[model samples]
Target: MGIFTRSIVSRKPNESMRLIVTTFFGVVFGFLIGLCFPKLSLTKFSLSTSILTAIDFKYTEYTKLGPSSSTHVSHPVGNNGSSANVTLRKIWVPSNPRGAERLPPGIVRAESDLYLRRLWGKPSEDLTSKPKYLVTFTVGYDQRKNIDAAVKKFSGNFTILLFHYDGRTTEWDEFEWSKKAIHVSVRRQTKWWYAKRFLHPDIVATYDYIFIWDEDLGVEHFNAEEYIKLVKKHGLEISQPGLEPNKGLTWQMTKRRGDREVHKETEEKAGWCNHPHVPPCAAFVEIMAPVFSRDAWRCVWHMIQNDLVHGWGLDFALRKCVEPAHEKIGVVDSQWIVHQSVPSLGNQGESLDGKAPWKGVRERCKKEWSIFQTRFSRAEKAYLKEINSTSR
Candidate 1:
């Protein structure tokens, strides 16, 4: 009985050993399967390590390296891609009795003869199919002394729109000396009103090309014929020559917020360069010397608000009409005329002590600018809509 009991105990021990061996082999087999087929594994250690390594390497390259550190593209045409083309027809000036007397009669006669010949020339006839360009000017009392000079400078088929703003008799008599020039005198009651209303209209329709210039802005070293040729080549709607003020004007620079001292210094040194797109469009001045096509003048005249108190908003008003339509406005290579630098209605206000008549004018201009912006925005929207609809 003792021997049988001992044998039973030994058999139990062997069964226990067999169970332990089976469990160990089973665990090993499961581990090998997991390594061979990653999708079966719960830990996912090997796959995770590979994905992490790839991400880290990709980020390292992208964050630390690439092209496009120092390159710039140039755009010669304006953002809207327009070019200026202009043709010169007849040049017009305005003057008074005094201005006429100051000018030389001989010079006036010479100019008149030259202009008559040019007007009768084949080229002028071919361009306008008309014999004359009704070049006209307004004359003030102070302008009589330079009448001859003015006449000599602007030799063309001419008309003289005389304005005797000053209370004086015999003013019309002064212009009688030039038989080639037509003269009309305005009464004091209607001087300003008439001058502003009809200043350029009569001749505007008479000529395909028109130049409205101050009497004092005389032409020197210029051939109107050559200028006309160049303008025709470019096909500009409005054109002006380079205007150099007799005196230099300084431009001011101001600092912007968050700009470093170094950047500010650089900008100051650079001043303002020509705009990438429109070379001569930005910050341009000199209303005294612009030449306009018949089309441009018509556009401007129609676009001008009747309520515009005076000619103070002419530049800004014209820009609004042209820029959006992608019309060409340009400066010519020729230095055509010398402006006398006379102050007009808007300039009456700028004083050293700040008491200027133009404060109201400035405010009006600001309001007008705002209105222009709104109008342009609406126009742009309309244009885009038309383009989209057409494309579809």
Candidate 2:
């Protein structure tokens, strides 16, 4: 009788244990099977594809909130709401969802070959990872050689974007890498316009660094990989390649020095004193070839005023992006580029009435300086006032 009771109890526990083990294995096996032959209709909210294939997904996630929505802008200032003053500038929406045929002005549709689904460039990952660098150039037909040299140096490590203000897209067809690049060909658009229209900070958030380079930089002394190595080592958030000294040198701080990999301070030349807030000796780099880190570009893009196409007054205010900007911004000397100083964009554009194209641009630049000062002053005052209020 005792043996019978013991056997019965032992058998009950053994059955329970076996049941648990079987259940666990069954669930795991089912999950794996689901992944290999996943339901095609499964969405972001669906058990995320059983966690097997989910980990290696190459496509962008369409979240519960959905893919990013298109931008809709309404002009309230105009009588017919068709025209706008400076306050209501052009309405530009750069990105659209896949299969979206309607698009904003100046937003070119990528050729079928350049679609995001089929695109390949620096990331190496199959559209799963962010690019480390996004290099941009404003070029003309005459600047092809310099642009080619730059593309060759950076294309493997960065996603190269070429903005042709001269309006010819096929000129670079001979270069094999041209097919790999994201090219925007719009006639007479300024560098700033291309940036405002296409390279919006949000659109380029996947990139870690943004290099807004001019077309005429001589890159013989520069290596893109070496420059990046120095940038990472020195912890620079906004930087540029040191310009070759005596090659139409514009600023003391930008001059290449043989002794250093990077420089934050520069000595004042004989006749000029380095102003505390002035550039080339402070946190500023000339727009000719400025490189911006991801976070820094966000702040810089917001500060870009509408109607300021020349971007003349921007370098002075670039400090607004990164705190202690002088320390965070520097010129890399170990890998530097020579500025050819070719005025490619100078001769083209719609000029002011009775004014030459270059002259009209000059006037606009001077006017933008005043506008920038006003905006900066007001912004600083508001910021300080808010800080003081919060501290109390």
Candidate 3:
């Protein structure tokens, strides 16, 4: 017997070990062969048809085969070829709900071309435009005789508004000749007080330009037409002619050094002394020669203190009003005008004697000074606030 068969038989001489040993050996051998050659064991296994029937099997037909008969299926072309079972879903690809529709590249270029063509044509016939100019002035006792003369010499197509303290009865009666020229008179208690009242109603009227001056100022080599042309050329809002002092006073400055002082004083003080940023030296001499644009007139008219007791504050009033408004106030070098400075009369209560008249005038000046102080302080504060707010 083989050694394996002998061992098995010897282990159980009185027992039925043959079947047990045979089954054990078969299981062990099959496992070893399966690990070594897996395909061989499956190919070797064949069950009878009865063995498949012994197992419980169930099958069911589908009521609906989804998308099986859809349009994507490829029909068999020939008997030799295989047919592909494909189904295409009728899905709606979402529209561009939030996306911008792209415009054609040439649309912008076409629009630009059309715009250029339209703009190239001549403008509409309805458009009407013309140059406008307005003239204005203030007159006092000294200016009464000369107002008509100045007006006649400087008159133009411009509308002239003349303000006078000496009433319509004076030498300004000839101004009535020009319907465009208006003469407004103020109550004649004091020249300074009345001058302030003259500015209100006249300034508010609508005009493209305004020219204010004392009538005593004489035009020398100044062409109003040429001056207006320059004004328009430079786009200046406020302009004054270069003033040569009628008194022919030379300007001189004084200097002080250690242990030595140099003084150059003139009895002839013409107008106010010109500073660097202030009006030019010429403007100072010709106080009556300033010409204002409509905008400047409007701004300056509001700042005038009509109740001011004296005429001393007019320059200060002008500087305050014009400087803050960002309007240009410049001296025209080409034009020239002369100022005829006149002395002030003493107060109504004073006698011509040195004691009474001087005292009364001094008292009046003090009263006017007090009024100026109050008004200037208030105006300055308001002006500063306006400027600061504008800057912000």
Candidate 4:
């Protein structure tokens, strides 16, 4: 081997051999250099990836934040010579968070309510007890006596809200309970109009149940606490106190059944119902004194059309919000109320085209009902079409 090596060394190499030797050594040197410095790239890359993953996890995990809470995060960015300790702050903010950070958590992000607060008391001392239910009456001064009677039936567990359509809110303060009641004075508006504006789901979220009632109803035979108990026991999410069968009752479904405590379905006129479980035959209640569970109100509130103030067709469509509507929607027959059916709101309308005020108002109610039906039908069709397309 020494002799062979000596012979090769003695021989002069060609230009191609020199070039080949240089190329081979160059390739090997580059590979060694790469292996030596691999840790710089691999270690930095893995560290950065881990840091980024941790930051991402924090962002998703801390979706809700208390007023005093914060996340302190530090991440090194860029290369070693120009690296920076990047402080990333993902502050919790409301949807419109321009100045929300400085406000109290309750004022900024908590569920709202209509509780009357004292001007002088500490914030926490404003309410002695938080009511579990909300009862709203769209009333006029003419029906104050009736409203007073109705309010008496509900206990302190309810928050009394009066929508004075006649613009006489202060007058209601004569009653002892009215001092604590929340009154909204908006003239010449229907109960549905008041409800849509003031009874937003967010505003009433604290209440377990919400009663949107007309002022004409008489609560002589009804007990609000008992009604709540019966509805809960029967698993009724949407319900109304049954109407006295004798007093100009429009539908048999709403008429009080003396034999039963609560009724889920009623036999309507022949061909009145499309199916036995559908509205009028079942899952039906008149809107006069309808009560809604918090969850049910969320859905029902969305269905109340902004333009259709009379709420003519809303009762029928309420079943859409609840599942097994026949089982979940019903009437508490034992806690029945008398529907006085006073045409007071109709008098609020102005005479138009030689028509009486009430006549014009009734006409609008009927017209709104037709418009609502058409809108509902179209909305259903559009929804079905979109669903079909997406499914395909």
Q: Which candidate is the best by lDDT?
A: 4
> If scored against the real structure, what TM-score would every candidate get?
0.45, 0.65, 0.46, 0.76
Local distance difference test scores for all models: 0.47, 0.76, 0.50, 0.87
Better of 1 and 4 by lDDT: 4
Q: What CA RMSD would you report for each candidate?
A: 31.0, 22.1, 32.9, 18.2
Per-candidate total of colliding backbone pairs:
30, 0, 0, 0
- How do the residues 1-392 of candidate 1 rate in per-residue lDDT, one tens digit apiece? 99999999989989999999999999999998878786646348755764674454443322222221322222223557453432211212223133443332333431121122344558656433232333444445566665456555444444433434344436546554455444455543222243346544433565656665554545564455556666677665666554333432221111111322111111222424343222223322234545667667767655544444333435534554455322355545553444554443344334544656566556766686567556657878999999999999
RMSD of 1: 31.0
Task: Answer with 1 or 2, whichever has the higher TM-score.
Answer: 2
Error of 1 at 307 (Å): 2.3
Question: In model 2, which residue pairs have backbone atoms overlapping below 3 Å?
Answer: none
What is the TM-score ranking, best to worst?
4, 2, 3, 1
